[model samples]
Target: MLTSLWQRLRADFAMLLAFLGFAALSFVFLKLASEVLEGETMTLDRWIITGLRSADPTVPIGPSWFETMMLDVTAMGGVWGLTLITLFVTGFLIVARKYATAGFVALSVIGGALLGTGLKALFDRPRPDLVPHLVEVSNASFPSGHAMNSAVVFLTLGALLASTHRSRRVRIYLISVAVGLTLAVGFSRVYLGVHWPSDVVAGWCIGAAWAILCWITARLLQRTHQIEQPGAVPVEEEGGPP
Candidate 1:
């Protein structure tokens, strides 16, 4: 009884933390959006965007190799790259017979993408004209698709994969990598003059909130056995009778 009570308490605490995180991120995103609509962020956005460029403003302020590296990093957050990653991860999960988890990952990524698209359309903000774009782009750009989608895909994958591990170090490593990738991608968008800094911040806020919401839902499903529990070992792997 004591052990069961402790487990319940831990679960409750985790859920509470998730809710708080989601709320905080959502609030930030909303506030940022309002400021953006009022054109309050434009000055700072232009300053940051132009600062990343050379005096000419057409070229980024970096060595050729550095610009190349940024392009490579930004590509990771592009639609085709994210799609391939999601499909590969989902395929791995299915092959492991974790069908529920696979489906959950697929749905979460797809839903987040669609939500991002709708938000972009709603905002209908234009790309930065402060500097010549280092990368070709054609879309509404209030919230960067690269930043938002990268956050969703990377963070969701990190959380899901971390749940399957028992080591605290491993979990931290996975989440840190996810965050690093997300941040790098966001920064690349700005450095390349393809998005305003505010757009990247807004994307991070909403994407993180969405990912947290999905995590909360996943925890609820796990509690109900609608999905596999964290660190659950397959019976076959445990040498149980087939």
Candidate 2:
């Protein structure tokens, strides 16, 4: 009985933490949005953008190879790259017979992309023009799509994959990689002069909140057997084991 009670307590604590994280992120995004609209972040944005460049705004303050590497890192957060990743992970989950989890991941990524797009259109903010962009970009950039989508995809995948594991260290490692990738992508946007610092920050906030929301949903669904539990055995077909 004590063991069962401890499990319940842990679950409750996790849910509480998720809710708090979601709320905090949402508040930050909203606050940043208002400040951005008021032009309150323009000075800081310009300063950071210029700080990353040399006297020549076109030249990023880094080795040529480093700039090339940033381009590659930023590409990982692009639509095509993220889509391929989502498909690959989804395929793996389906092959493992975790059909519901696969569907959930697909929907979460798609939904996040749509959400980011809608916000960009709604804000209608212009891209940073203080420095020449190192990469091609054509979009309203209040919240960076690359940063947001990367967070949505990477963090969601990390959380779900971590749940499937039993080792605490493995779970921590997976989550750390996700966060690191998200941060790298966001920073790359600013370094490339394609997005303002505020834009990346806003993206991180909204993306993280959405990921947390999805995680909470997954937990609720798991409780009702609507989705496969972590480490659940594959269900056999009527005919028997394959």
Candidate 3:
């Protein structure tokens, strides 16, 4: 099984390349964030101090109802309540050793937390002082943890569920949910005035890279399991199935 998975990965060379590409992209984001977002927590911080006040938001979907609903979901619920709820749930699943699914979920939550915290510490950025902060926060805010965590958890969990099943409909549903939720979370950060547009963008990129790494780790661990098991020898590539 280990050999088979390795063969499979090599057979589709593009997949591995994608992983590297995302990591590189995330590194670039970090560099750019450090250079561009220096001591200028004015816009997002100001908005956070004041309150969410959209002059105009582009309509989502075709109908006004859909657009309105998305605004609320992404801006308020996702950034504040929903994001934390998902993190706790994912952590529980991981602690229970429901790997693959649990790893997928945990990667999103823990990875986001770590990445967000690391970035904050690296830059030592300051929070906004424009408004009265309802929630107590001590970290700097370049890449919003809420945005990053939400993106990873929803997207990777969706991918894991899709992969474990062999149904096309299930895959589509899972992927769609992931995309929608991630977008919602990102939008929420911007809408709720806690993050800048750039912060959200960086969060999305970092979250994606971290999630992919988790997937790769899970795959490698699975391979190790097969190798450690008794009598689970690898078969030679006898031109049977390349």
Best by TM-score: 2
- Candidate 2 lDDT over 30-95, as tens digits, reads 999999999999999999999999999899998999999999999999999899999999999999
In model 3, state the lDDT of residue 56: 36
Regions more than 4 Å wrong, model 1 = 236-242
Q: Positional deviation of 23 in candidate 1, in angstroms?
A: 0.4
Q: In model 3, how large is the Cα lDDT of residue 220?
A: 53
Query: What would the TM-score be for candidate 3 when compared with the true structure?
Result: 0.62
What does candidate 3's lDDT look like per residue over 1-242, in tens digits? 99999967773574577578677967967675765457444555455434444333222224557545655666433444655666665665555444445544554566666666787677665554443332345666767676676666666666554544556788789779877887787775555445556677777777777766655554455456621211122444466546
Q: Per-residue error at 105 for model 1, in Å?
A: 0.5
The stretch of ten residues in a row with the least summed lDDT in candidate 1 is 231-240
**Which candidate would rank higher by lDDT, 1 or 3?**
1
Model 1 lDDT tens row, 53-164: 8878788998999999999999999999999999998998877777898899999999999999999999999998878888899999989999999999999888887766
